[model samples]
Target: MAWAAWLVLWALWALRGWSCLRCDPGSMQLLQELTGPYLSRQLRGDPGLRERLEALLQRSIEGLAELPIGLPSYMGVIDEKTMGEAAAHFRRAVTRIMENDYKDGQLFNEMMWSLQALRESFTSLMARFQREVFCPNKCGHMVHQFIDCRACRTEIYSCNRGLYCGERRLQVQEDDDLILDCALSWHRASYGAKSYRFYRARGNSEEVMVTSPDAFLLKKEVTANDSGRYRCEMLNTKGWVCSELRFQVTVTPLPGNSTPLPMPPLLGPLTLPPSSHPTPLGGPGDWTVWIIIGSSAGLVLLLIGGCAWLFRRQREVPKEDQDSPGGQLNT
Candidate 1:
């Protein structure tokens, strides 16, 4: 019974035609048409080119199909003889291109154009593939495109044609609302009429909305809980273009009650202390100290002289000598 179930599952997978999980069959077919021949040729002569082309193809396949296929692993599945035949075809094509001696500038421009086309084609393919792989019955139902917030690791979704496009970062405080602003511009060389859509996803919830007129801005205000991924899409007569910017919304906690720290005063150059200067032994300040010493000494000398005069006046010997001399003269 288990074997029967397994076989049935395998059959179902095979019936899916090994398509990519995120790409449409038509877009994938276009990619194969555009890149397959060149890639096959590169695989034959230049081993390095072969490796690079294989890696790119593998990345495209993984991005579109969500398959666990690697270049070496896939090569092992192919027979040696088949690989040789493919290589030979690629080598011949490369040889012809080299012989043509295409001008460098022209070749560069052509390559650029081809790469741009490839990118657009791959995006459509991936979108279709995702729809098929995830929502088989609801193919026409709107699917929310997911953009990742680089800051908070949140995944947000928005409508296909909304206003939030080309936003880089968003921040909100807890219990406070935050507003998001997004603006978009297109390359002037794009000649087709363009339209856009926006998407935002938070947690498991997603939202999608169409954008307003061209050259317009989108503003969205939501609380901290609304933080998530935001992105936008551009569509025109040519096809669809997506904004490369992934806006991340982060919600932070509010600050508690605290005074603002004051800035320190700016200090000028340091001045040397007056005492640090070498003082002359007989400088002006030294002379002042000496003058005070000299004045104190003179005051002491005057006090000593007054004291001696007072002591002499207090003595009786001077009066006796005067009386004796007068008596002798009279006799």
Candidate 2:
């Protein structure tokens, strides 16, 4: 588990760098053209040459930003409007470069106003890339649940009941997975520092669907048995409940069935009741699938550490030669 945490840290670090550049696989070369030294000191001084070059560059930045696969790794939604603005600036920069070009091809020279403009544009685009483009965390979104979840993670602040509180009533068909979010932040400090526990109220007892070890609340292949009042709580590291979210799940029948099943018990408070049973977060959770990526980082770190140790060992003098000068036995 310690290794796992370290691996998680490493993958997260690596992801930070990978996310800085968000060009699509098909657009890498185009990105390089925009950011690279296409504006070199050397180019044909012919009158039509710069225009042709500008035209080519303009084509490169026209449809620059494709929809990036948004996953909420940093735990917030991408700013689409800002992202669009970035792509716009990306287009504007090259246009500026072309407009400011000279016979000398010195587009990036200090006196070039367009050079600064281009730089500023790319800087803005780069910031968007970090915050929205490659962010890795998943968020609890209220939009079209199937399509909207893929984009960057987003924190829910509006459209819910209270500032930090929200309730979602879902009418999911049978056999559909029931997924709920327990990572609600009631205050500034309560979001990431807590673990989530999920429960479904039975007759007199509430069965533990998911416990504190997992951050996600999920019951896969949910059937009629799974339909019940669901409560999710966020607990601090010390195992004290800190925040809660209520979910009302109505499991509708599959196609061809007209009548709807009974609704689950009423939604409960986000906070826990006085008496409760705590259970281990079971099934390794779906998050284990993602942690597999961290193992590769672990192996790479181990290899680097092993190599460093061997190199340092080779540089050391043998302990048996402690008395010998220059780490060599006389004669």
Candidate 3:
């Protein structure tokens, strides 16, 4: 019945523009020729009234189309009062338009049928909404943080403790999977034996979903594309029992070890290269490189020191021999 009614609304929507275009004073006969055969011989509405009602029907279709198909469990709850107002306006318009000769005009009867179809569509959608959406089960206000621990990025769901997902934002290293771990007791207690369906929403489009009878292992191998606001929902068979958590996932690069060293310029006659220039032995940067360069200088210093010590010793021995005559001169 819902499908049939939906089809009727679609047909009405498709024809609404044509009905308006043809209702112009010049194209009355053309409109009659087009729609007169389909509308039964039970409504003979006035021409002006018929035009007004057609316009009203167009407005009705517009309003219905604006409504979201399924009541989003997160935001934009269906407006029952607004829907009722539209239905009432439609009813009053129909009542005023089809006063006396309602059962003799093709156009008037067609309008009435379209109105009924619109009403049915509203009823069906509202019933489904009440059964499923008007009442949602659990959860909200979550921001989870995940750190890349070499192998994987993981975060544990706060087990019925607080509303915030975590203290920090989700940080995932490039090419690691994000794992969301949570205890399932809260949902189990709320939903009882009913099955669960998981839905994830990102940005402003329709949510992508998957179904599981129990707690689903949530692991997403993260990439640059995975950075976004993510909402995870757990819903059950009755649709009344639902739980959701909202969070943001951000991906970052791996840790770096060190920065690259700068290259030395080529040598010239007037200006020597960095290699040709004498470098200080001790410095803050490149200690190991400096030690390698100063090794030869250390050996030369050792040889000069030994020569000076021998010369000093010879001078001291000569002074001692001159002073004492025969102390000792061992070759």
Candidate 4:
């Protein structure tokens, strides 16, 4: 009888673990399908670009596979506001791509499509889960169960009370300092104090105050030496929170510049001096000369007109005297 009881207990524990393990293959498959086309497009231009993209995609896939299923499940359950925050992450990634290049154009369009698909998938999954689990009268909240502390974790929840609600998570980067950003906010009552506790991995890893709850801004400069896992604990006077958020931070040195140096002066095509052909109109002095010439031409035309007028008057007086026949002997 005693053995049977022990067996039943072990079986129950195993079942709990399996339920907490929220791995779904659909997300991984979708991610690959979306990114594969993008990388293939980039590969056509530069063989090196193709190789780099392949490596990056491989690493990303492997990392996602290693992630606890709970992470994606939590992502699936995120509300619209939290989902917006996730969208921003993708936007930032897309923004990192350089513009006006072939790779940039392809990557930008592909990323936008991928993000939209991701958002849609998450919304649909959450809706299905909500229909199955959520109840209006129940006060219980659902959160993503965490398995390890020295790694990344994500949580999603909705309040049954409907008075106060939020979703909080921690993400670790490959650099110094943990990033903790809130995605959703509710009533002032839900805006109480929260704190994140940090622990070292080695022996006597002293507990440190990484963040304190307040309205003040929390900004931590990232460095290469600050890689470690961290856990966040939120607290308020109401009661102890049930959800625990964990993440692993890895620090990587900044990459050095690898751009090729410009070619030597003699090796490149010789650039000729810009053309210095004379303009049709000389300069400011030329304008002055034109003005003087115009004035002289006008004066010459006026003198010619006066001489022609005098000649006409002389001819007219002779004709008048001949017609009158009064000055024949004088002529």
lDDT of each: 0.45, 0.49, 0.46, 0.44
Candidate 2: tens digits of C-alpha lDDT, residues 38-65: 4443344343543445454444333222
Show the colliding residue pairs in model 4. Answer: 174-250
Tens-digit lDDT track for model 3 on 1-331?
Answer: 2332443455565433222122133333433432343222232334543344445444543443233334332122333333344345444544444453434334335555655654555456556544543432234222222221121233322213333333224778767887543334344434234444444545566465555664554566677776665544554445543445555678776678347897555664566446665656675457977787799789999999999999999889867777684775768
Error of 1 at 148 (Å): 42
What number of clashing residue pairs does each candidate have, in the order they appear? 33, 13, 9, 1
Give the TM-score of each candidate: 0.23, 0.28, 0.26, 0.23
Q: For model 1, how does the per-residue alpha-carbon lDDT over 242-286 read when each residue is reduced to its tens digit? A: 333456878776679347887555797766556877778888988
Error (Å) of candidate 4 at residue 229 is 1.2
Clashes in candidate 1: how many?
A: 33
Winning candidate number (TM-score): 2
Question: Which residue segments of model 1 deviate by more than 4 Å?
Answer: 1-167, 173-189, 202-205, 214-217, 242-244, 253-331
Question: Mind giving the per-residue lDDT tens digits that candidate 4 earns over 1-331?
Answer: 2332332333233222122122323333443543466546654656565565455544443443332444324322333343344344434443443232444445445444544554454455545444533222232232332222113244433354432233333444444354554222221224334433433444446464454554222437666555555444444444455233444556555457257887658777888765586446677668889999999999999999999999999889967887786656763
Residue 328, candidate 4: Cα error in Å is 99
* Error in Å for residue 326 of model 1: 82
Give candidate 2's whole-model lDDT. 0.49
